[model samples]
Target: MNGQKLLIVEDDLGLQRQLRWAYDGYDVVGAHDRASAIDAVRAEEPAVVTLDLGLPPDPDGTSEGFATLAQILQLKPDTKVIVASGHGARESALNAIGAGAWDFYAKPIDIDALGLIVSRAFHVHALEAENRRLATPATTAFAGLITAAPEMLKVTRMIERVAAADVSVMLLGASGTGKEVLARGLHEASGRKGAFVAINCAAIPETLLESELFGHEKGAFTGAVKTIEGKIEQADGGTLFLDEIGDVPLSLQVKLLRFLQERVIERIGGRRAIAIDTRIVCATHRDIDAMVAAQSFREDLYYRLAEIVVRIPGLAERPGDAALLARHFLHRHAKAMGRPVTGLSADALAVIDGWGWAGNVRELENRMKRAVIMADGKLVTAADLDLESGGAPEPINLKAVREIADRKAIRHALARAEGNISNTAKLLGISRPTLYDLLKSYDLHA
Candidate 1:
């Protein structure tokens, strides 16, 4: 035995004993009914399960066995379920395959044949697990970026390619979309020796912004008691991040254009042109082209600042990453808050997926921090995050009503099971096969 667990959900005492002894290659456990089977699934998370559809109350009926199958899959979608069918239950065996069963076998159990099926399922499980492990980025790869979705690799590639360059770069994205973080990543990638200074053009007052960017000499103004270096001089040997560059006033734009062109600055009261060496990386949510067309922003300065432009996708565009990030945030916050919180409830995860996330990564991070603090149960629920599970109510059509109800019920079971497919099926009082069919019909993932 390789220590791989195999759960056998069979009601027959003789057959159960036969299976436990016959499967010498597996550490086997037996469950006599729906309740025990689901409990075993939640506990053991067995790589494979052999289920017989007939139970005590419905010894001749397929209902109970089928129910066990669904709940098991609901609890663990990756578990390979092997359903047993008698000669008369061949149709049910076929239904098992459609419901996501790994394979099916008829009664008068052929030990060698069943062994082959079990071995294949375990092998597949190992391969898939390995693939997922390999898909995650190594901690040192992106420095600060956290993503498991394959699509984010494209953005990573772009950042890597541009990191070593000295050219001016512009980042375009909605607010709170990690533009500044990426700007820092770009600076780190460049291997620059100086500090990275950042200022939000939109946040500073229009009158004081000029002096903020360029230093003032003594007697230059009422507060100029001593000479002060502005943001430009302060970033002499490093990078200067201009956030919300679109809102920079036109007069200040001319002065900034001079620095980019001359590589030097002059204090407000001093005539000496002081030399500075700094790389410029700016970010904004506005359309600079539109501003240029309307003459609100100078076209010459736009070209100078935008030597390279990177467009960042909103949180919704990176599929699979929302769940990955939500988990990341939950763990991080739970540890910081010293909470016993574990993971997101299935409905909570579903809510994370369903929400538009207009605030992107920042919004997700904030919600997770709050969820960790508010979580009363072991896992974070949609209520903790204040997220709803689905769209608005549907019309009175029977088909639509059934779909809406089915989706909601499936979501509820998944939430209660904490995404345990087997447990979900058990809760629904249906077989794993039936649950799989329903999930497929509703276009939902287990």
Candidate 2:
């Protein structure tokens, strides 16, 4: 387990030392004044903080301390703050709690009792943090796929079932629907001991396509100074993913078909045939059937490559998946950029669910990355997501409106509970019965 951090905000040096020594069990950090305290809170982001109610400019009053507490919470509302007051005990304690402190302690310093309270505060904080992390929508299951839509779930299940079989698999989906990710997952599940190699047929030049798949001997071409293995040979004992396989030139299709049927390849300059034991997984956004009818793509190769076909649904077809993936991307990008983003706002989520994600998961990820960098507030809003800023507000249909409402309620409940259903219902001012009704209606559950 990682050591918990404890921030003590106190001006008294001698008392700071005593408190610091007392909390030696923790990774204790100190701040002597309100300014340093705020800075420390921003920098260290401690899970628990101890604040002294009597501070500098108004050392005899609780004004500075109260202001500090408010700022700390504004910066990180999840931080557990325990206020210390040497003044009127009842009044100070009540006031501190009112200002959003986790707990309050009367001072004349009972070290043991204070230690117990601090420990309890840490425990509560840890539990709340853990609950939030687990309840986060992004971490939920999709068989390594980050989607919440039933259509996508069905696709994922199909992929999972097919991965165990050693058949040539073809993934049919629109661009940016994570075809390669699914392909990699199939490779991993197949228990293949070699590398998973991928090549985009459309991205490579036709003249060099054969050399790329079947390699070339030294001096075979002008740049061919040394013999290099192609994608097929490199994936000898694993899976080879051919992305945009529909784009392969008709000339190379025969060679690819030969390799598939014979399990062997001949280098461009070398006459000897080299045998390979590689599984083929192919993906294409294009309609290969049409291409074959037009005599553009080889029908024979198409038949060999598509032994078991899996169709991935577009983002718009997957209900609530856009928002789910958006939050996931936000968390990832925020941490990578070292930004302190808690979550998306209600308006942001509503916009996410309502919008038609034409570009799918990849588009959502890019938008979230931009939003995380540009957002000036702790929580991202629809404006930050670029969904509400420039575009004219589109009229919503009743079904769309219901989806928005359902998503909002579920997300709000999860947030309030930090993902605990009972607590979330209580926060929503409803009984667990009403919560269950809503969850069922929305097709959502804890």
Candidate 3:
């Protein structure tokens, strides 16, 4: 046995025996009725269940089977329930999915096709379980940042080390690469009592950017009705996150450089210089070196902010994070929106893993939120994400589709098993020799 329990629920004794014979690697348990299925669940806590939606009492209908499905889910929401029904297959499939069943199969079951569904359910369940385990705070390298990729974790560690020095730190990364989040993490680790204030230089108009950074006195201008504290003053005794620092106009760069040099600011229309104790943490997607060489940004200011520069990796640069974050976002948005999305479909996960998320985590979050709201079934499919591949349309040949799926599954299994043939075969519900044969046929290496 592979140490994974599978509960087979069916009233037909012959079919029950057939199922047990089919799944030799699993610890198969039989349940002939709804009551017995519930009892079996309580006793075994199986990871996957193959349920027939035509149990006794309504063996000719789907009522009893649906009841069992409901009870099984209520008892163990995480259980992967693949429900089968011969009556009204389409309607039953839709109803079963709405009731939170992992998958549905029409009766006259093709054991081969059903086996594929069961194997995939197990794979998805395992992935979700691992994601939940890794999502905990204890497993993360930093608070509020969720990542399982080594490169991203390395960036977190670098931030943790740089937080204590209290020097100006500049973060360099592509847009939406979580520069502001890391800036806040640095502030939290610095143990600052004051508030962490953030200002996006690119979002603000140049005319008002100075007043926004360094406050103006009351009646400083025609529209200045009341005295206001600037972001720098608001972040006193804490960290000030300056996003898109490269967008600061050349005219204002002089004043910013002066403040960094003097550790004091002269608010607009006010001569009273204010000495503020603030740590500056700035970020920019632009190349500051290019800006300096182009004479667009002040060299002095660059040196001040770049005292402890850190480069953040893009989403594609961090392997496995796209799928991890996709799952995280799906659950978060589903709960917030009260959607019935239980998890990502195998197709959805594969698309996410293979996608090049140019918009980074922001793009992934937006996609998941949209997918959760738009998904009709219990599981979010790749179609819901609206991120279809930019390449050619899917091949029409059935052989081609099978080949593609097989290659992807093999690659994913190898990754999860860390290139161990034994574990890979177990994950794929096959023997080592079978895995070796497929790998050779597909030209895949473990």
Candidate 4:
């Protein structure tokens, strides 16, 4: 057994026995009616279910099948129920999907084709379960950010820890390293009532940057026709994310420092001192310390904003994250675009693992989007991602080859085990101590 439960809900005894025999690896259990299916669900709690829309007492109709689907989902919402029906196949598929079935198969069962769907359903279910595990309360503390790498998880935990405290946080990382995403995650974790507002200092001109951050009164400038709240005011009782804070001009840094010190702001061409309550969270790709030394950025302002400095690792530094993020992006885009792209090809996974993601998660996401649009097959290939599929060259060095093989095997085991050390060790046929030694020696993390 693969140690994964699979529920086969078919009314025909012969078909149920055939299905049970076909799936050799899974712990296959059968049910011929709604009551037995519900009982099996309660007992087995299978991750994936091959549900038939022709249960006993209503074998010719889908009423009992749909009811069983609804009850199964209500009991275990994460269960992947792949409904099968021959009656009005097309319409049944659509209705089953609308009724919360994970996927649908037409009866006249081509076991091979249905097996592929069942496997894909299991893969998707595992991916979703891993995502939920990654976003647990002790980890992410927010949605939209998905990562299983320990390095990134550490960063999220730190953000979650500091969210409730009223302090300035400065995220230092390279461009496209998801600094803004972390900032937003922090805001959400903070439980602030006001909106989370953000501004990219590097994207705005220095002339308009001040007005953008501090707001402007009517006729404050040539184009200022009405009074408006700035990002800080809009973020009152919440968090303000200033992306690329090193890009803030030296002149404006003085005014920003005043706001940090006094918790007050003066809008452009306005005299009233507006008291504001907002948490400051800023990020920058530039070396603010070097800028301070060069007199381009204020040293005082740097101190004010650097109350809690977090250094986020680049994508390359986080092992397995590139492939994980690629899978996440592929699923997101494929579903939104209504594409049938199931997963990434083996060569695509190789490229994702080997490539140094210089543009980080943003580049991975863009590539997945293009691949989803351009892919001709169910699996997204390296070519679909516009990436080189040429496998890494063979090594003449025996030691190098062994190390490479070990790394690849360890990564594969970790992924298969979903980052469970004991399971990974078991998969690799190694003792926990040996696996730990290998992980430390290879600088690998799960």
Candidate 5:
């Protein structure tokens, strides 16, 4: 295990010395009061913290201690906070847990037991942090495509397979679903010698669109003094990605179809047919079949371009993928910005899983980037991602209410058995069949 930094937030100097000595394995930092504790948290940014509820200015009450806890969480939400209260152990522990503390301990501090709890908290914190890192979207092969859904996986596999071939490839997906990244990946995989050129058919005007694709000869027209090579010629021996190909004008479509069929291009105002070697990849979020039906797009050109078609799945279709992508983006942006972001909280992960990401992977990436930059604490919370905190705690219907109870029971049993359902049921004084039923009801596997 990696040696982690630990902060002890006790006002008693003697107890601080004892705790620090006991946790010799940890890089222990001590803070006797609220000001010092907050300072320690900011400066050290420790992964796990031990907080004493009896603090200065309100040493007998939990007011100051709870305030410190709230501040620490607000600043660095990822830190594992373990609260210690001498006066009212049960109340303090429960209150702390409700307020988002990781775990709590009663005091006349059992040094060994507290040490074990602290160690366990640290282990859990580290594991969660690692999970978040692994789940982060930026770590995946594709830059912004976030999905673990089998349908999306099939599309990715298709892209991978077709990328090795020299055939014309087309991508179909909804807007903001990251077709361009897939296009770029195809270019990278093709082993092309020249640059991967890109042009958006819908973004550029029709007047300049022709000039954008096919080069103009010197004095080809007014303001064409110098010879200029279009995107196709520039991408010779490489890939030319045409985005929003459905919007290409009829005139340009004929020219493009001719080039695809003959492998030759006639630059504007030039007589010679220039033999060019360039791969073509096109993408459109629109339904090409409908466009072809409407006679807005050339059917012949569509058939020629879409020799291999890949369809990308939207974000909501992928189960567990949004959380994975969120974590990935957080790690990347945090590292790039030099922030001490540990990972997303459990609630945050749940929110990510539940959200309907209509804007797809692009939206998820943007949210994570912003959350990582703005996060004051080590862990990103649901609130940081603009998700509801604790995520609809109360179930409205009987079915949902039962499901919630079942989920809670299964989670508790799993925890008690250290994630072994068989052992957990035995501990819960329940049969394996009953446990399995509970698991199924809650949509929980383990």
Candidate 6:
């Protein structure tokens, strides 16, 4: 706390001195207006800021103060800004929070209560900063998988385990979920001598997909001028990644099954059978189970190909990952595009975390690339990303929304209470049992 800098954005000199001296442990800094506030933020990099929503040229209103708050947060997202409002404190507080202020206080400041809020804000800010720093774990060479989300971590562990075994593996997830990336990771991990071969069963028509997967001899067809080896034989002793395997034509499924079972392929119009020892890794966004039920896919082939199945959670399921991945993408693209942009604004990070990311990693990659190229400021804003800051509304399920709200409230109280359960319960105006139930329901550690 000694080194934790505090920025006071009060235009009034008496109040500024009073507030600065009141917080003895903090390294206090001052900014009298919107411009200075943003300057102090860039220069001092304060961890917390107490801002009065009344500053000149608009001291009679909060417009200037609101602008200052936005700019300060844009420079440093993790800096917790506590807003002070004399007029309509309650409504202003809510609006400030919506605008990304950490907390709000009323005028005629009770120094002690405001101090408590400041302390709580700093403590939570530290916790979150540490969480972000430690989120990424040391994993194997998965170059494309950029995540620290627990669900993705589990998938990574599964990939590592299955890749070591040299058996048929199936990956299931929504489109743009980085299936090909994981397939490449599997190939890198498999320690095979041959090349990593890939073929999208869905992209190619059924008439040509079979020949693509299983080779054809010379004069096998009108276009077959020379004896060509297919993806399977090309892989030889490496890995064969079959993307969108669910789209493999039923007529070709039998041949794939034979290759998996017999470890040999019969080239079209060829008498001799060639053997290969390629590890098969297949992925599909389609529900192969439903296809098997409809007889669109062969059940026997599905079983043969799916010696091990790994389900990759969609981007929505991997909470707390979007911002982390966004940071990575921003850094990578900024360097590649020769941009001076180094970070994202608070509003940009807020929108990224709250967005649904329907197209998953692919969409994120595109947005970040565009943002890096278009960004004019040192930090990327929501405008740069071409994204709406207003997030999608929550589902109309009262129970779900209530639980979400309760969990958030409980977590806030816990942060204020400094991890003391009894204090948290008291702060939340709830019994210990109720608090315990919430913690359990939300799978919170404490």
lDDT (Cα, tens digit) per residue for candidate 2, span 272-357: 99989999999999987899899998888989999998988888776656767777888999999999986888778767767777
Candidate 4 backbone collisions, by pair: none
List model 4 lDDT by residue over 1-446, tens digit each: 98788999999999999999889878888999999998888777799999889787999888999999999998778899999969566787679999899988887898999899888988998888766544543113245787656578778889889998888999999888899889998888888888899999989999889989999999988988999888999899888999999889888999999999999999998999999999999999888888989999888899999999999989877666777778788999999999999888877877877788788888889999999999998999989988864323444245557877798778766754557899889978999999999986666666
What does the lDDT read for residue 248 in candidate 1? 96
Tens-digit lDDT track for model 3 on 1-446? 99789999989999999989998888999999999998888778799999988888988788998889888887678899998867567788778999999898877878889889989988998898776545432125466778755578778988999888879999999988899999999999988899999999999999999999999999999999999989999999999999999999999999999889888998889989999999999999998899999999988889998999899999877655676677788889899988889888777876787788888999999999999999999999999998875312344345546766777677566654546799779868999999989976655556
Provide backbone clash counts, one per model.
Answer: 23, 0, 0, 0, 10, 0
Query: Lowest summed-lDDT stretch of 10 residues in model 2?
Result: 389-398
- For each candidate, the alpha-carbon lDDT, in order, equals 0.83, 0.83, 0.85, 0.85, 0.81, 0.82
TM-score of each: 0.58, 0.61, 0.60, 0.61, 0.56, 0.59
As a whole number from 0 to 100, the lDDT of residue 371 in candidate 4 is 98
lDDT of 2: 0.83
Residue-wise lDDT of candidate 5 within 252-324, one digit each (tens)? Answer: 9999999999999988888989989999999998999999999999999999999998887787655556766
Give the lDDT of residue 273 in candidate 3: 91
Model 5 segments beyond 4 Å from truth?
Answer: 1-147, 387-446
How well does model 1 score by local distance difference test? 0.83
- Candidate 5: residue 63 Cα off by (Å): 82
**Clash pairs (backbone) in predicted model 2:** none
Clashes of 1: 23
At residue 194, what lDDT does model 2 achieve?
Answer: 91
Return model 4's CA RMSD, one decimal: 19.6
lDDT of 6 at 64: 92
Alpha-carbon deviation at 304 in model 1, angstroms: 1.0
Those runs of model 1 whose alpha carbons end farther than 4 Å from true positions after fitting are: 1-141, 390-446
